[model samples]
Target: MIAIFGSGETSPAMTSVHQELIARVSDPQLNAVLLDTPFGFQENADEIATRTIAYFREHVGCEIRLASYRHGGRATALEFEQFLSRLGNANYVFAGPGSPTYALRHWHDGAVRERLRAKLRQGGCVAFASAAAIGLGAYALPVYEIYKVGADPSWTEGLDLLGEVGVRCAVIPHYDNREGGTHDTRFCYMGEPRLRLLESMLPEDVLILGVDEYTACIIDFEAQSVTVRGRGGVTVRRRGTDRRWQRTTFALSELSHPQVAPAAVPDSASGRPEPDGTDGSPMVEQAREWGAHGRDALDRRDVDGVVAAILETENVLNAWAADLVGTDERDRVRAEMRNLVVRLGDLVRGGGREGVREYVAPLIDVLLSLRGEARREQRFKDADRLRAILAQCGVEVQDTPSGTAWSLQSQN
Candidate 1:
């Protein structure tokens, strides 16, 4: 199975898909590895590897090994063999966030591609997010080349990993990108106009698999079904017509049979309906309501309520992530989700602080009582020691006529 993430590799939005991929591995402790090929060109490539390792360990509850293939030819012969060994042994391999062309240059017709193919044959999961996802298609869009470097809008020869599964298509990540707020950069910074021109260059049999940002399409070979999990759906463009499926299950047969027209229902993205009678716009509206409920809970400082509300929204989002169309609507829902998460974090921290204070108050009272007894018994040394210990803890103990009052300096 290949899990292709649109974007947001290490972000909260991708948490669900990451976990899903991890779950696909039946191993009690998954031998997860990250390929540094994509970001290998960056000066801070090592830093990216380190951060991703920590993220998997801390967030995903799995330790990830780094499969460093920084350069195609720079490494020693022994080092190259070791890199291949590590990649071969990994049960779950992930590559994300960098230059597609650069990564492809190293992966194409190389040991990297062979090892990946072998791993898949052995039932290992290959998860590609963002740049890595873009490189697995029949045609690789040189995004930086054209968008940033001003090269002509063109399609480069991709790794074409999808060809193994009998699907001839170009994988376009960030399908619903809105980064260029003023202009149209929907197709990973290549606006629809340029994207159309690029599509014209493709052969008739090849289709366009446009995966929206923060979205993922998991292709399950065994089940022969493609599960779309993330903030957006998968867009299949055949001969200039796009058929998008979100938050819904579809057969793998749909990929090969491009002529099977989608049901006529107004889609939220383009206001065009699919051949299948299902429309996912209602799911989006439900998610929005949950987001509003979460915000309400946050406003009232209802910690449990906030958590419940957010979890409810997540349930809806995950259940309908494929159904979510309309870049604007998806963005709004995602923004609300992020805000909810942020505010929920704040609430948890605040509540934890108060909980700690409350918990310590009784312990402090017991200690004070023991110290009072010691003082009354003429155990001056013990009383002084207790006062000194409290002082060391930044707690001031005042022996007043009424009683001993203790206050934590941190509270002040």
Candidate 2:
């Protein structure tokens, strides 16, 4: 059985979903394993993992261990093998809330999918939610790149776990997102604009499997059944058309044979995940000169003064990231309290939140680390090469007193 949750994986709303899925586990002794790969790029990955474990321990009545596999490039051979073992050996596997592209980049290149396939094939529950759910399809959307970084609409090869089970389509979670309030953030934040563009780009054989927020679409391959549970329901969009299975429990066989709909009402209603709180160190709030302050670079030739205003934004981002994770600041603070998850919520929705600001600072430090190494070794050529690399990638690196900062120049 494959349980796909649209969102709210760790929220109180999802406790029943977790409990029910665990109940379905045939194993006498449940060994729940959490795949921490998707969100591994996060600086506070350890904290997230800890909170998740606690969530399971407290609410779900299951003690789950983390299978920490963050970056594929950074993992050793033994580390990769160990990751594979954790999935293969576990009866109930759960992964949620991370970058689809990041997880795809790591899993599709290796045997992670196969291990998952084997686990499902041999009969066990594998629940993947949110961003992880998006990767279980024939094609994957580069959500952050296209929606946030201003990249062109495109698709990347996915794990195709859905195709293995006879569903030829992309799995788009958060299908009913409305966090944008004033903007169209539906269709996984691609909006109708980019989504329509990308829909035309899909292969004829593939369709779209969209699950609504706070919903779970559980597929039982053996009995050939699909049960929709939660506040919202499932949506299976056919190629280039508006055909979909909006609500109600349906047969899994219906996927291979989608029928004509009688003017089905669209799935647009969405609910925000309940905030999970984390205690964070108090960060001094600063005045807003974000767009202007970052532009005061001393000189292009002055490497010491070179910085990116974006990184300063990222510092504020890092400070506030913890507050968003389990904290209900919306009741106290307003706009400023909106951290990474909420930022991620509506960031790609409107015309205003464009460029790479949507991605926060996933890879900025990696580039800075390389440049720092070059400068420490007095390798001026290598340091210059790093700058060129940033420039070519459309990142504008400028000077700041605290450190070097960067932002994405419009790729268009």
The true-versus-predicted C-alpha distance at residue 130 of model 2, in Å, is 1.0
Off by over 4 Å in 2: 243-247, 262-412
Superposed on all Cα atoms, the candidates' RMSDs to the truth, in angstroms, are: 12.7, 15.1
Candidate 1 — which residues are off by over 4 angstroms?
Answer: 259-412
Question: Residue 45 lDDT in model 1?
Answer: 86
What do the candidate models score in CA lDDT, each in turn?
Answer: 0.74, 0.68
RMSD of 2: 15.1
Clashes of 2: 12
Q: lDDT tens string, model 1, 113-168?
A: 77887766777888998889988887898889999999998888887778877788
How much is the lDDT of residue 314 in candidate 2?
Answer: 43
Give lDDT tens digits, candidate 2, residues 6-52.
Answer: 87677655678789888878467787899988889988788778878
Whole-structure CA lDDT of model 2: 0.68
Model 1 RMSD vs true structure: 12.7
Candidate topping lDDT: 1
